[model samples]
Target: MEITILKSVIIDDCTTHRTVLKRLIENHPDLVLEGSYRNGIEAKNNGCEKNADLIFLDVEMPFIDGFDLLESFKKRPQVIMVSGKPDHALRAFEYDVTDYLLKPVSPKRFDMAIKKVQRNTGTMTGQSEDEHIFVRSNFRKVRVDYGDIKWVEALGDYVKLITEKKNILVLTSMKAFEQKLPENRFLRIHKSYIINLDRIENFTSTEVQVCGKQMPLSRKRKSRLLDALGAG
Candidate 1:
């Protein structure tokens, strides 16, 4: 499938960071950097649709941070939080960003995250469907049916997978899981939580009840979840 350019914005306080990010966006076949801002105030004052398709944002900035700017937007966009430190990753996930890109971002890592977004973009329009994910378990590789996943939670460098009757913890980044799982079926409700939509029994703006457990629901992901349910 041909990936289309999505309306995008970049917000960072560092000039070098902006330059690096701009290059990455320009290199991507499916991303268009709409504007670059030094801080949240500039982005907020521009008077454009706060509902951008994607946002490459810095975690710490003068005047207002990325998190504050995200709150100001009436309709939050798909956010990819950019940070220079690993400590803020948990906070980034609390906002349920699309992906977290560490400083000095690698082209490979950036491309991987973009692919996940592209897949979701396609699924939103009924263009494709992915049925399973391959994982390394017990010193061997195995395929896990997408439907079998109940919920996934981050555990440091790995993620705990809860399936129909099994709980498996794999040593992998949550971003890997995000990329492997189909977005239409799996939604990231919080930094630590990703749940299968079919298995969801109840959910509020702040939490999703799945497998009889309540997972956090952040403002960043709530709109997307509602839209997914509506589309389904």
Candidate 2:
């Protein structure tokens, strides 16, 4: 399979945080660092969104806050808001951001956020052909039958693909898996989970039982899940 490298830009006022984020982006195999700006003003003036698919933006910046900078963009890129203050999370969601991370972001959390971006981009691009997908497991390529997957769980930098007789760990994102799987057979019921619809044994408003394992269901996704099952 060919790799899709996403162009990314960093807009933050703090030098230390910016440097750390730059390193993280550079280290990711799927991301390409395009530009780094010290403030939102500079980022906006340079038309960062025009050339980038992803943006790591700071909520609080020196002149023209992150929100204002977003407003200025005619076409917005996928944004991951990095802020010291958690209070901006609610407002950030209003813009339908990919994810919000508090300052001093951990590697695990950052990886999760990037997964969200990858998934969102996949939806925009289009879904893959159903049947099977090739995944790397145990340092070797493995072909997973879509029908055999019971559910998928998100790990920090990888996803656990659970089938009836085995659990395969792949160095990939949940969003990436969600995109590859046939939508008719799978549904994302939570941020960290995507279950094979045929494997569901029972479900409630708050949880789902699949392969004798219960997984939490997000309230926001409950209605969508029901609709997918033709129960809504």
Candidate 3:
């Protein structure tokens, strides 16, 4: 059988830890490092295309944390946690990570994780396509569908999820809300705004009109947002 080619992204803060993880991933003949990021914000801010197969995510970073990074993408990639701290394993599971690797990871263990990743590719197919997601709101699990999500706006320590009929300002980070959305349907038009593509009526270079509400579209995101809407 031909060795399956894998594209990977590495995000971590510590230089030593990133170097170790890079060496480990490089040792595997089947895994290829697509990019390495020193921070979670840089990784997510860069955006994910359709082909990113896996992400070696760090649990902690400067502006945005690992879990937040995972949550920011509408299309969730198969993420293997790489952290110096072991206690973050439970938290990793909470974000539904594919695997957990503690710092100073051995090359052998890294190869093993790649093997597991290779074998599980079938199950990983379209894993993020499922639309319904449960978010903890008011100490209860609330079910929200992709269609119900109007837009996501950032707050100090939370994100405001405005639905068609109601608005929920959850006590969570923007990164957390980012992870819950479907990539094909949601577009982060600005650092402070992620709009549901399906809900938009029209848009301009500077703003998007969603449900009769005009929201500014960041200059950087204008093209991608248009492409996502099939307008470009």
Candidate 4:
């Protein structure tokens, strides 16, 4: 699977803060820094929001604020509001912003925000509720049906899709794969395992049986997994 890199833009009035954000955006493998603007007016005038997938916007800017700029966009992308004020959090969420990060962002918090973006917008370019997905295997693309998949296992940097017939290995992150799958049908029981809810024949507190294979179940996700399976 070829993961689609998110085209991101950074808009901030402060030069120092913008520099810090630019570094963070460039460091992320999945994000491609498209443009960096000093203010929302400059970003709007240059049409930076035209083809951007994500935006790191500062709420307080000279002349035009972040919220005003967001409202001006006819077609808005996913926004992660970076501001010093905690009061803007509630209002930011009202606009359906992906996340609101306080000033001087940590690497860990930035990663969490990126995960939220991945969950909201999948690696796939377009949005779809289709039953099938195409994955690369053996240097070729193979279409896999959602119903046919029994489970998914994380193997090093890749993930193995286990079906009734064969297990196909694809180069992709588990989080990225999880975003592609329907939550109702698939449940992540452990960090490395996502199982098909319908395929589970039996389960205990510590493990689940799918196609005669026992999969380890995490204590934290045990209740959620059971709830998903309707066995709680």
Best by lDDT: 4
RMSD of every candidate to native, in Å, equals 10.9, 12.3, 15.8, 12.7
Per model, state how many residue pairs clash.
1, 0, 4, 0
Per-residue lDDT of model 1, residues 122-184, tens digit only: 522233346677788667777677767889999998898898768887889888878888665
Q: Looking at candidate 1, what is the lDDT of residue 138? A: 69
Q: 1-232, model 2: which lDDT tens digit per residue?
A: 4568899999999999999999899888889999999998788788999989999999999888999998888989998888887667556655667677887877776776676676657632334565578898888998887767889999999999998679999988888878888665689999999998656666666888787899999999987775554333
lDDT head-to-head 2 vs 4, winner: 4
Candidate 4 residue spans exceeding 4 A from truth? 124-232
Alpha-carbon local distance difference test for all models: 0.76, 0.81, 0.72, 0.82
Candidate number achieving the greatest TM-score relative to the actual structure: 1
TM-score of each prediction: 0.58, 0.56, 0.50, 0.55
lDDT of prediction 1: 0.76
lDDT of 3 by residue, 1-232 (tens): 4456688888888888888877876876667888888897677667742357889888878998888778788887777887766556545554656567766776655764664465457422232437567777788887777667888889888788888667776888877678767676688888888887645655556877776788988888876864443223
User: What is candidate 3's local distance difference test score?
Assistant: 0.72
Give one digit per residue, the lDDT tens place, for model 4 in 141-166: 99997767999999999999999778
In model 2, which range of ten residues has the least summed lDDT? 122-131
Task: Specify the poorest-scoring 10-residue window by lDDT in model 1.
Answer: 120-129
